[model samples]
Target chain A: MLKYFEQLGHKLIEWITIAREFIRLFFETVFWLIVGPFKDKPVNFKSLFFQMVFMGVNSIIIVFFVTFFTGVVLAMQAAPQLDKMGAVIYVSSLVSISICRELGPVLTALVIAGRIGAAITAEIGSMKVNEQIEALETMAISPVRYLVAPKFLALVIMLPCLTIIGDASGIFGGYVVGTTSLKINAGLYLQTTWKFLSRKDIYTGLSKSVVFAMIIALVGAYQGLKTKGGAVGVGRATTISVVTSFILIIIADCILTGIYFFSDM
Target chain B: MPEKEIAISIQNLTKILGGRKVLDNVSFDIYRGEIFVIMGGSGHGKSTLLRNMTGALIPDSGKILFNGQDLLKLSVAERERVQRRFGMSFQSSALLDFLNVEENVSLPLVEHTKLSPKVIDIISKMKLSLVGLQGFEKYYPSELSGGMRKRAGLARAIAMDPEVVFYDEPTAGLDPVVCAVVDQLILDLTRKLKLTSIVVTHNMESVFRIADRIAMVFKGKVEQIGTREEIRNSKNPIVQQFIKGELEGPIQIT
Candidate 1:
């Protein structure tokens, strides 16, 4: 019985060690990515533009559709409950605050994880398997500077932008549901939502997005860079990256929520 | 010139894998402008030795001197700088599938040099032309045949005008005519560029066609080093067996 317990303890320790190494690599990659563009060499604007289009601009449609449905669902659920209490006017306010503070950022991150994270992993992993990364190294070009830094900057700058769009679209979605489905006054719904929503709530959503962007970019790039074997290896890395980024974003959202609520209290 | 002026010198190099010595205390020197071929049977540590020379693998114990500087002692940055002086072609012809032929050829120049895009493009086109791939620049790797991909890889290798170029099985997995074209390209490039070339191949025909000197690796050691005529006419039974393509000999096929 003691041997079995000891074996379990050993396995747990091994898992912890692996997790710690992964975290260390994550932060180290972030540190280099932040400092890379500011170094002696001039920044490659062309690469940066490509990354922005790839990571940010391309993700807009998905973000719009997701946030829109979320808002519609929120209004549909809240109207009947609030109508029973003679507080149907508060439904818009509830949708606004919930979407802006939590739902928008979290859902956008999940979508981007599947989209951007998978793309980065497949791209980098294929490069590894093909020796394109080694080819870059052999040319005296830093792969981190050329490949990773641009993607990191693009994600950091774009995730917040995406969240803002998501927040606005979600409010618009709520307005649609309130006016059409709930037979609420459109002007009254918009005015109550604007009055109830504060800058703090919007800022919280954008802040969570920044952290999610870091996690997605770092995890995706790490898995891609470390890919081994060949096609099968790249496929495995991409799957792991998407799944891991999704889980990390949720955990980060929960922790940030706890801090935001408790600290205010 | 004295032997000490060798371009590359390896001493007591060893690499262990799975509790067995893949390379055991192997040592050799390559001259400044000679074609050095490391010929061996498959899995005879030939490619491993080439990778070690290029600083892609760290040996368990050894010293590698390039231009009399200890390559193993350099920092990663310093080693990368040294590595830039050479070019490498892989056995798999590892071309970037996303890039067209011209873009793939122009990669090293775009990464390392301050040349304008126009000049880079022109030079890339010239490289493709040099490799007999003039009309194929706009095509992707998938669009090209296997032989064309190998030639495209060669174009990329010489894109930087490297001092030393390493070829890992340049003629493997190709028909005889394609193999001859690749071999001829190796010879032409060596002569025209005056580059120090090291090729790891088991193809005897390729060795005869391009090698200025051949170093046959056997059981993790250099079994012989000689000119084409000397290797062909030598009385060494192992060399004789290998040249004759015999399945039975001192070489154990496991």
Candidate 2:
């Protein structure tokens, strides 16, 4: 028991240090974002554009399919149960609410955590190993501004855009299921979705996308900048970054949902 | 050159990595407009000291004084302002693989300089030509041979005409012919650009050929620093072992 507590204490301290580093990278990235335009180098539009295309444009197809199938699956499972209760019409309400308030942002964030988060960590980790990041420093270029800033700003903008798309794709998938498979009235399905869904729900979900984006960016950058060893170290960083981003996204989702539930947002 | 102004003064800079003293109270002065090489065996602290000099790695203690400023003591913004004129060549070249040679060479200017694109282009070409990489401007770093990649990196390093250029093992993995070419290039460019150079290398031949002076690091400490003649005729056992590539010496075989 004593040894267990000792190990627990060590792990706790390790996690605390990691969290500290993560927060530092988060604030540093944000500070770079605010001051980026005033510097001699200014904002790197070329890299920023590339990052948006990489993170948002490239992620659309996978996000669409994942959310689409998810919507289909959600409707398939929930509709039958609701239909047995003589409340088949409520399926639209359930689908729309889940997609807008939870599924869209959360699923999109998870997919992005697996995809873009891994890529960011690997790319920066490789740069660190090769000393390109240090080369940037010696040249007076903050790796944060040149590397993390573009990706951070791009993801902060793009994750929401992807979430909006995912929300639409999911609803469409649910609509298809409702009309064809579930045999619900099309007009009623549309009407029910419109009646139940409010701007607050959609706004809340989209806002979660912004937080999730920052988490992914910060976790990836922190792991990457702290990477040592070499290629093997980069692989480890990529793995840890994805896992940490996923965990943070889920935990953040729960916290935000609890806040909205209690605070009337 | 009689006054021999100090370009960089490292005062007892120490760095501990994983509990090992990577840079143990290293102190040296790189004179203005000369080729200064830091030589050591593989595990010694030459490269670490070079990293410290570049202001990329803050030491556990001591100071790296450059341009009337201590690099370790400055804020991030201030360090970057001072680093604007610095240049570094990495062991693996470290050129952006996605960018072509010309683009890599022009990165510093494009990011920092207010020069017109047309003028930047001309300067990029000139710097590439100086490194004998003019014809390979369109070739990406991945496509270039090892020697050619090093040349391209050097082209980029000197593109800004930086006051102090740091070269980390400029000819680590190359043939004798390529190594000679690299040595010649370093000599020619440092002279032509009138820039002070701090080179970290364990290559004895390269050091004797290119260095105006040499600082030999042994077991994480600076063992000896002097002119080529002084170092060549030094009484230090570890320095003699390192420079001569001998196994039988005061340095314990790990």
Candidate 3:
């Protein structure tokens, strides 16, 4: 038993050492990638464009559909409850505030975490397994600069864009639910939603989306970059990146919401 | 040969994994424009030694000097800069299945050079043709046969026109005919391009065909370093056993 414990301890230490080296490589790559664009070498606009298309354009449809469904479900659930309290007219206000302030950004991030996060992880992991990462290193190109930096920048830029679209689509969904299903006046619904929504709410949602984007991008890239073994390792990293990003986004949403609500109270 | 132009000088190198020594105080030097081969049986640390020379793995002790500068002492960036002078072909080919022959061959140029895509495309096509893979440029790795994939990998390795190229078991998984083609390619590249090549292989035929000098690694240390004739004439019992493929040797298979 003691021998087995010792073996386990030794393995743990080895894993930790590898993890430390991975972290160091990741940060070092990030530093060089940040500086690479300004160096003597010209920036690669083609790579940047590819990243924008992958991180932004490819993800829009999923974001739009998910946000729309979330809005519809929230309105449908809230309508009866609001009617019970004789506050049926304020259903739009509740839906808009919840969806815009929290649901829209968090749900959209979750969708992207599932879609784009997995892709980044799988792509980088495949590069690692195939030794293309090693090839890049051999060519005096920082793999992080050539690979991870563009991904990071793309996600950071596009997450907010997706969030804005999600916010609008979600509101539109609530309008559909209220005016069609609940027979509420469309003009009154819009007015109530406008009255309740604030600049702080929008800004807060966008800020959370930004934070979630960073986490998803960083964690996904980190996991992918650290992948070893081969095909099996890449697959495992992709799965782990999606699952971890989803859990972290939810946890972050709770904490942010707690702070936002309690501070106001 | 001038001492200043030594491509690689490894001294007193040691590597330990799981407290077992993988390479023990191994030392060797590779001169410019020479085909140096490291030969050993399976699990004899030949690949480990190659990886150490390439700075893919750092030694627990000793130095790897590339062009007189200690490769291990350099930062990752600096090490990578040194690595640019070398290219490697992995045993498994390691081709990107998603990328076609042209894109795969152009990877190094795309990553490290500011050359326009048109120029890169032309250079990529040239490399493919040089490897006798001209019309197959649009085919992905999965679409190619085993031999063609290896040729494509070689094209990629030489795309940057590296001074030194490393081949890890280039003939391992190929038919005899394909192996001959690969061996001929290695010879042609060395002679035509004046490139220093280090090949690790257990294939005795490959070693005899391409190696200007051969180093035999055994149990984490170099057991012999000599020309093919010198090695064949060696009186060392282990060398005799290995070269003759005798099972009754001092090298106990574990």
Candidate 4:
């Protein structure tokens, strides 16, 4: 029991150390992003543009396909339950509300955590292992300013935009099911989606996506910068980054959802 | 020995890694325009010492005084100001893989200076040419040979015209011919650029060829420091064992 407690204590300490470092990295990136431009030491916007292209533009197809299919599944499942209640027309509202309020943001974040999150870890991990990060330091360059800040900015901006796209595609998928399979009128379907999908629902999802974006970017960069060993280390960091981001995204979503659900917002 | 200007004075520098003293109170002075080589077998903390001096790894304790200003005592902004005068060439040539050679060389210049792109381009070309990597400017690091990569790394290190240049195992994984070429470049650049060069390596041949003075580290300590000839004739058994490449010595193989 004593040995187990000792092991537990060590694990706790390790986790705390990691958390501290991660927080430090996050704040440092934020500091650079905010203060860099005024000092004539701006976060490299050219690199930021490239990162935006990779993290945002490149991710559209995957986000579209995933959410679209999810929308189709949601509509299909809801049709039967509503049919039994003699409320088959309510399928459109169910699909849109859920897609905008819950599914779109969560799914898009998960995909990004797997895609761009893994990429960030792999790239930075390899750089860390190769001593390129140290080289940057020796050149009086902050790796956070040069690498992570741009990535953070790009992801923060792009993830919400992607979520909006995901929401649209998912609702479109539901539209297909409603009009074709359920034989609902086309105009009514869109009207029902708009009616049920309040501005609050869309904003809440967008806000959740922003937080999720921060989690993915920071977690990926933190793991990447912390990576040691060699090729194996990069692989391990990438895995942990994705897994950690996934967990954090869900936890954050739950907390935000709780806040939104419980409190009068 | 008469009043040579000290470029960098390392005072009782100690660094502990994984609860082990990787650098145990090591102290040394590297004079301007001299090639100071820190040579030791693998894992004796030579690289760690280099890292400490270059400000890549902060020492657990002790001072790295660059021209009498303590690096550790400075504010982050001041430390960076001092750091801008130093450049480090990594063993793996750690060039950003995505960046072509010209961009890699121009990185320090681009980051530290507000030079126009045209001037940065010209300066990068000059630095590349100094390392004999002129025409390969457009080629990415992945496309370069090991020797060319090292050269490109060297070009990047010198981009800022730094006062002190640290080379971590510059010729570690090169063919003998390429190793000799790198050694010659180190010697030529040291003279031509008038830069203080600190090299960390276990490559004995390159050490003898390029180093004005050599410091042999053993068990996280500076076992001996001397001129090449002095080190060649040193009475220290550990130094002799290392220089002679003998199996039986004070240094345990384990």
Candidate number with greatest lDDT: 4
What does candidate 2 score on TM?
Answer: 0.95
The i-RMS of candidate 2 is 1.3
Of 2 and 3, the candidate ahead on TM-score is 2
Task: List each candidate's DockQ score.
Answer: 0.51, 0.77, 0.46, 0.88
The candidate with the higher TM-score, 3 or 4, is 4
* Local error of candidate 2 at residue B164 (angstroms): 1.2
Lowest-sum lDDT 10-residue window in model 1 chain B: B1-10
Candidate that would win on TM-score: 4
Per-residue lDDT over B1-254 for candidate 3, one digit per residue giving the tens place of the 0 to 100 score: 45536788989999997788999999989988889999988887999898887767778999988888998888877777778778888786777665788888998888778899999999999988888999998898988898998899999889998889999889988999899999999999988898999999998888888899999999999999998899889988888888788999898996
Error of 4 at B2 (Å): 5.9
- Would candidate 2 be rated incorrect, acceptable, medium or high by CAPRI criteria? medium
Sort by DockQ, best first.
Answer: 4, 2, 1, 3
The lDDT of each candidate is: 0.87, 0.90, 0.86, 0.94
TM-score result, candidate 3: 0.89
- What is the C-alpha lDDT profile of model 3 across A215-238, one tens digit per residue? 788778888987898889999999
lDDT of 2 by residue, A15-104 (tens): 999888778888888888887667555668888999999999999999999999888888999987997899988888898999999999
Per residue, candidate 1 scores C-alpha lDDT tens digits across B1-254 of 55634889989999987788889899888888888999988888998899888877789999999999899999987887788789888777888786799988998888778899999999999989888999998999999998999999999999988889999899999999999999989889988988899999999889888898888888888888899998999788788788778988888888
lDDT of 3 at A174: 89
In candidate 2, how many Å is residue B160 off? 1.7
How accurate locally is residue A129 in candidate 3, as Cα lDDT from 0 to 100? 87
TM-score of each: 0.91, 0.95, 0.89, 0.98
